[model samples]
Target: MTKVSTVTIGALALTASALAQTSIAQAQSTEHNTAEKDYRVFEKTFGATKGKRRNHTKGFCFVGEFAPVDNAILAYSNSPIFSSTSEVNGRVSHKGGKNLSPDDKFGDRGLAFEITTPDGDYHIINVNTEDFFPASKPADFIDLVRALGEGGEAVKALAAGRPELQAYLAHHKKNRDTTLRPYEGTQFNSVNAFYLVNESGDRTAIRWSMVPSGSQGIVVETNSDFLMDNMNANLTNGTVSWDMVVTIANDNDDPNNAAIRWEGEHTRITATRLTVTSTSTEADGECDAVNFDPTVLSDGFVVTDDPILEARSQIYAHGIGVRLSEKE
Candidate 1:
């Protein structure tokens, strides 16, 4: 076995502390920007046209309840939903700016769920993947989007020579590729990290995911409405459920890194069961009227210092506004 040096360990610890401080500072600065200005970067980068919505614009809505598991692992945070079951309104969507049908295989897939608590509504927006791409910092994310929008040539150049782009691609290729899995088999992750603080002020860095109970091999290509049809058929039989699990961070884990997957020794505890009991077309669903901001969290769960979390909230609000404007 290789001998580890105390100096190296100390350096690593210092680096981690610095990163945490930087993340906190960035989050504070980003939160102060006007919503419109914050969103303009996302719109220009991911939207098909200026002042429009994102690429994966179409979605199906659902009504459900999130039931706490009897043996659920208790964290420090005391979010209301954890104490009792709460009604939920949610949506599953294709990730893009264009109004593509559910069956379209062009972009990533996403899920946005809102839980109604006595204090207020709590939202969790996730994509059908274990990790997020590019970088967790808002500035890096914006740069990555710009590079992607520049097309194949720019991407090729970056892959061949750019250090930042090369590192990002190397780290994220696996998770990004896995985003194409069928919805039934997909695992939706709360990409941003958060703090679970208890009444006594003890805090734990955590992230959560809604994962399918079992693997159902890859799905074959079908019609433009295949995903919707599949969901409808499943609902006809009964409610569909997913395991809601929270992954607690290890001592050495970097809470702000969205690109890393906390695995192996990291403890994952079952928090609840998310059951989708009913479905509705987008036009008839509550999703159209609700803004699913991930930052709209509950009291016990505090937003982490991660800047990406704030960026997501701003972009989501922009997407909602754009969607509403289209209807007018």
Candidate 2:
């Protein structure tokens, strides 16, 4: 009886060991698959555009400063950008193919800005849109780009059959008010998930928006240079300010999904006040050489596990390399 019991116990232990090994192997396999998928998507998308300038090809650059609101810095991120003032370099651009002029009214608009803080430089690249397209995964984004590249025919073909593409298109609406109003009044969104680490080492997933301090200014004229002219005129008069408001994530939130806007009340703290004071049209402007990668973050802030964010860093790095090679 004792011998039979010992044999049974050994068999059970062996089975448990085998199961643990299988679990580890499966986890590793999944990780490997994800890495490969990201690599393939990066190559397929950005590789074709190598040597050409980035999609938001043309930009009007500016110089400014990000000043932290003293009372608003509690319980949120400990990043220096929110605790101290920092010099900033920024650009406002029309989104489309490279060489598209600021006057192009057909494409999306973007704000790419960098803050040089004591800890490190933090880059914030936002768009006028509230949500990102192909909002969930790297492959989804690759497909969306490919479909759009093929034009209306491809979109129509996929729109009926592909729910993923359909969902993306439904959420991806350009801000029509952007061109009609002064750029200062236009709200810019992070679009991607990011984490704000507090002093206790606790991390809170959040998305932020930059809202202009004043009411939206009406655009009297419709021209290509109108956006630029308004910005310059405002800067000459005084610094234009934006309030940084963050929406904290709840348990129901999906950090990996960029398409789903955070639902619920937002914590509207004035974390940092961004003030743009001057315009720079110089070929050697500070922002001209910078990649303005959103993944380039400072301490106390981190990008979430969203595949699109990971893939963006890789693509932007590749684009920068290609651009530099062309210059050389």
Candidate 3:
């Protein structure tokens, strides 16, 4: 029960009194109809790809959020392959072995999000990785929520000079049954919770997110061999964690897409008020992918493989945003 109720947002609430107070059998576990029509359109259709054995080895994941927003901003769909129309069974990078086509390979990393106080700096809207990543992993998730909004102590010194986030939290804390499986036909990786008011404004913080659930996101499988022969099955009980409503503009000069028109109208980001968990420790299967140790993200940011080929030649393809802390 983590704060979801834009009147329950269901039936993909494009609106109908919010689809009559939402509830098409829990509307894909609600969160403003699964965080904008199924979590960021299903991880911009599978984080643009780089799985299933790509010798570059590792690095490819992202998720973002920050609350109490005013110049609120959030925009995803960086376009690496949203439509040439099909094939994304592992997100991308066949390399020279040839045979790529999640719309002809993808992963050229380029991520941007901004919000610097002092009365200026407001440009937080990115997602364009239709495909590109000759070699990737330069600290994703929008560089860890702008490094916790640049606070003091800087996220425990970026968890002590990253070694790929300390070897991905010590290889998922003693092998979490080998994590990694939220990027294959998405479903239930929706959590973008952040609330900050630090800088000595009398304390208040929060951050957490999940967007590594690819393939146009929200896939949830369980045809049920009786729920996988009862292998401790819970399959997201009473799920729903959405509410990504942002609005904060200073005009990036809208020539129809550079977009910036806050004050209301055409502003959208809603998984419809949410916060629900029935005990699940973030991780899916066959783990490892959080990479951020270029000496703790080399001050102000530095992740290359050429932004994964510039996040697949930019425009916003591998669209992911998440800033978790909420409580330093």
Q: For each candidate, what is the lDDT?
A: 0.64, 0.64, 0.24
Give the 10-residue window scoring lowest on summed lDDT in candidate 2.
Answer: 2-11
TM-score of each: 0.78, 0.78, 0.21
lDDT of 3 by residue, 184-298 (tens): 2112210111122222332111111223221222234433111111111222332222233422122332211111112234433331222222221113311122211111111
Name the TM-score of candidate 3. 0.21
Tell me the number of clashing residue pairs for each predicted model.
8, 1, 78
Q: Determine the backbone clash count of candidate 2.
A: 1
Candidate 2 yields a Cα-based lDDT of 0.64
- Model 2 Cα lDDT, one tens digit per residue, 1-328: 2121111112233343453344345435555445445534444443333334456666677878888865555586778787788877787776655554646365566777877775545555554544554547776666666666677888778677767567666755442343455667677788888888888988888887787884346434657667667776666565577878777788888877886767776666667778888777625465555666688777778888887777776555445444544543
Off by over 4 Å in 2: 1-52, 102-106, 119-128, 172-179, 214-221
For model 1, give the RMSD to the true fold: 12.7
Instruction: Write one digit per residue (lDDT tens) for candidate 1, span 197-294.
Output: 77677889988888876333344456676776676566665447777888889998778777555666877888887788778886667565566777
Considering lDDT, where higher is better, how would the candidates rank from best to worst?
1, 2, 3
